[model samples]
Target: MRITRIETFLVPPRWLFVRIETDNGIVGWGEPVVEGRSETVRTAVEQLAELLLGKDPLRIEDHWQVMTKGSFYRGGPILASAVSGLDQALWDIAGKHLGVPVHQLLGGHVRDRIRMYGWVGGDEPAEIADSICAQLDVGLTAVKMNASGRMHPIGSVGEIDGVVERVAAARDVLGPHRDVAVDFHGRFTLANARRVAPLLEPLRPFFIEEPVVPENSHLIGQLTRSTSIPVATGERLYSRQEFLPVLQAGIAVAQPDLSHAGGITEVRKIASLAEIFDVQLAPHCPLGPLALAACLQVGFATPNYLIQEQSIGIHYNQGAEVLDYVLDKTPLKFVNGHIERLTGPGLGIEIDEQAVRSADKNGHAWRSPLWRHDDGSYAEW
Candidate 1:
């Protein structure tokens, strides 16, 4: 069947969803957002759709290469994210046509279910112990939180002590068995990363995310040598070529987002490349249902897969949540901190098209916050 229509929706809580329609009446859903820049990605998808109309819906790889490389200049958050959403929809269509889940198309599942983790304590840390305890009470085995609210290029020891205290509180609540990861959120500098890294070492975190930024690969090697904790990054990275240095640098985990990092087609390759270096896969997904579903499909197929990051009750979602626009949330059923393998065809979860159409009318224009320090200088938020 041929692709007939491409539609996009900018919904609440800073999300953009894409739907691909085919002549045979089978449709597929995808999330191709760049967090705050939903509208820009939407326009990118619309422009790409001009070339995609009347093409074979099942030619996912060809379409992927064309949609991405078909342009002379390509691969960044906006263009790649637009291509990412389209790639997801193409895979979803192909899976439905074959009467199997996307994982099956990727060579089937290696395990039963993939463990998932959720965010707590918002962007900063406060009442985090209660949040940890609440998730633990719900039978979640893993949770991740931000390490600090904001910071300077060189932070004070008192600031480091505050982070240590927060982690200590989480460790106390988590006891010794559960896994806890901290996202530095690229707020820490190499100097600060070194200082904070060793302090959190005794707590034995599951990992420390973006100890610095991906731009600081050399510094990552430096920090990892100083600390025993596993170093995880790559949420902002867009390609396998970009990830080679991260893997070669001895990064413990690769956290590529299926939605942002070229969707299923490219992330599977990224997972394979990471596996060769003995790096684990812990997809970074803090968006909506389609993005989470896409990550799950990859998680099931990748052998070195670790826990998946989800945004079920994340601080980013103010009004609309993951289960908001879906018809059946059962496919995403989280139990005992893990979501079972999706059995349904395509991305496994069906969207409420009517709900989507309605939400599209409300059509949001969401952007992330821009933070600044007391000196009126910019600080990562």
Candidate 2:
């Protein structure tokens, strides 16, 4: 069927949703946002719609190649995220048209269920234990927390101790059976990460995420070698080419965000590339339901898949939540820390069109938080 209409919705709590409608009465939805820069990515999506309007909806690869290479000045968060959402919509359409799930089209399921992890706010160490316990109350066996908020470039003894204390608190609550992953969140410099990673090694964290920002990925190998903790990154890295260096840098887990890293089309290839390095796939998804569903589709089909990062009760969802826009929450629910295979077509979860339209009426202007050190200089948040 030919794509007849394309629409984007700026929903609450910082999310951008795109809907693609085909002439034969089928509609597919995708989330294409760059967290705080939804409007810019929305504009990019509108522009990319020009390439897909009146074209075959199932030609996902051709559309991907053109949307990515169609512009000479290509490949950044804005463009990659734009292509990501549209790519998700195209794959959704393909699955619906073929009457199968997206993972089936990708070569069927590799596992019956996918493991998932939830977020627990660790910016404040006081709440780390309580937040992790709250996640456990909801049946999540694993949880991820930030290493620190607005950490000093060269952390003091206190800052390093605080990071350890926070993780220790989480580990105390989770005990030995459950898992805890620490997120550096691009807030640490290479030196600080190197110093702090070793301390967390005693706790045996599931992984240390984004030990350094994407720009400093060249130094990640050193961090990985110095510590026994598994290193995971790629939430900021946007393509297979961009991920190649980090994969070669000796990461043990690759955390590509389906919403940011060229959607399923490119992330599947990224997973394959990481497989050659003997790394595990743990798709980073802290957005909305569509993004999570897309990640699950890939996770169920990918052989090296480790775990999935979802934002169900994440602190980011202020005015909305992951299940708010879905018609059926069954497909998205977690069972014993794992999400059972999704059987529905496309992304599997049917979005509430009415709820989405209503939410878009009062769209949000969410922006990332700005942080500064005690001396009033800039700091990562």
Candidate 3:
């Protein structure tokens, strides 16, 4: 069957969903968004649709190669994210056509269930304990929290102490059996990260995510070597090529977002490359249902897969949630901190087209928060 129509929806709480239709009536859905820049990515998706219409829906690899390199200028968040959603849709179609799950087509299950982690707002140390406890109540054994909010460029002793205090709070709540991952969120300099990572060592965090932003990746090896904490990054990174240097920098975990890093097609390759380095795949997905579904497909087939990030009750969701647009939440239900392998074809979870269409009419314009230091200088948020 040939692809007949490609439609994009600008949904609430900052998500862009793409729906691909084929002549024979099978439809596949994907989340192709760059979070705050969903509109720009939506335009990119519409432009990419030009190449997909009237083509064979099953020519995934060929379409991927062409969509990525078809343009004179290539490879950025918008283009890669655009290709990412379309790629997911193609894979979904292929899986449905073959009457198997996407992971089965990828090779098959490496494990029966996938471990998942939820987000806890750690910007304020006082709220961390309660937030983590809430996640625990919902059966999540692990949770990720931001290490700091607006950190000083060269963190003061107080700022450093606050970071330790926040993690200590999470550790106190988690106890020894549960896990806590600290997200540096690229808010720290190399020196700041180096200074603080060792302090968190005693708490034994599952990992310190994005210790330094993607731009300063060259310096990550320094931070990784100086501290015993496992370093994880790649949410901002968009391809295997972009991830190679960071992987070479000795990160212990690769957190590529399936929605941003060329979807399942390229992230699977990134996981393979990271495997050679003995790194684990903890896909960075704090988005919507389709993105989480796509990540799960990859996690099931990948041997080195560690944990999955899902945005069920994340603070980012203002007017909508992960389960809001899905018809059946059974495939996404958490059982003792893990989601059982999805058995349905394609992405496994069926999306609510009516809900999605209704939400699009009142689309959101979400932007990342901008921060400034006490002295009025720009700061990472």
Local distance difference test scores for all models: 0.88, 0.93, 0.94
- lDDT value, candidate 1, whole model: 0.88
**lDDT (Cα, 0-100) at 311 in candidate 2:** 92
User: Can you write out model 3's per-residue Cα lDDT over 1-381, one digit (the tens) per residue?
Assistant: 999999999998999999999999999999899988999999999999999999998989999999999989999999999999999999999999998999999999999999899999887766998999899999999999999999988999999999999999999999999999999999999989989988999999999999888899999999888988899999999999999998898999999999999998999999999999999999999899999999999999999999999999999999999999999999999999999999999999999999999999999999999999999999998
TM-score-sorted candidate list, best first: 3, 2, 1
Q: Which 10 consecutive positions of candidate 2 have the poorest summed lDDT?
A: 121-130
| Whole-model alpha-carbon lDDT for candidate 3 | 0.94
lDDT pick, better of 1 and 3:
3
TM-score of 1: 0.98
Worst 10-residue lDDT window, candidate 1: 118-127
Shift in Å, residue 325, candidate 3: 0.2
What is candidate 2's lDDT per residue for 267-369, written digit by digit as tens?
Answer: 9999999999999999899999999999999988999999999999888999999999999999988899999999999989899999999999999999999
- What TM-score do all the candidates reach, one by one? 0.98, 0.99, 0.99
Mind giving the per-residue lDDT tens digits that candidate 1 earns over 201-276? 8999999999887677767888877888999999989989889988998899999888889999999999999999
Off by over 4 Å in 1: 122-126
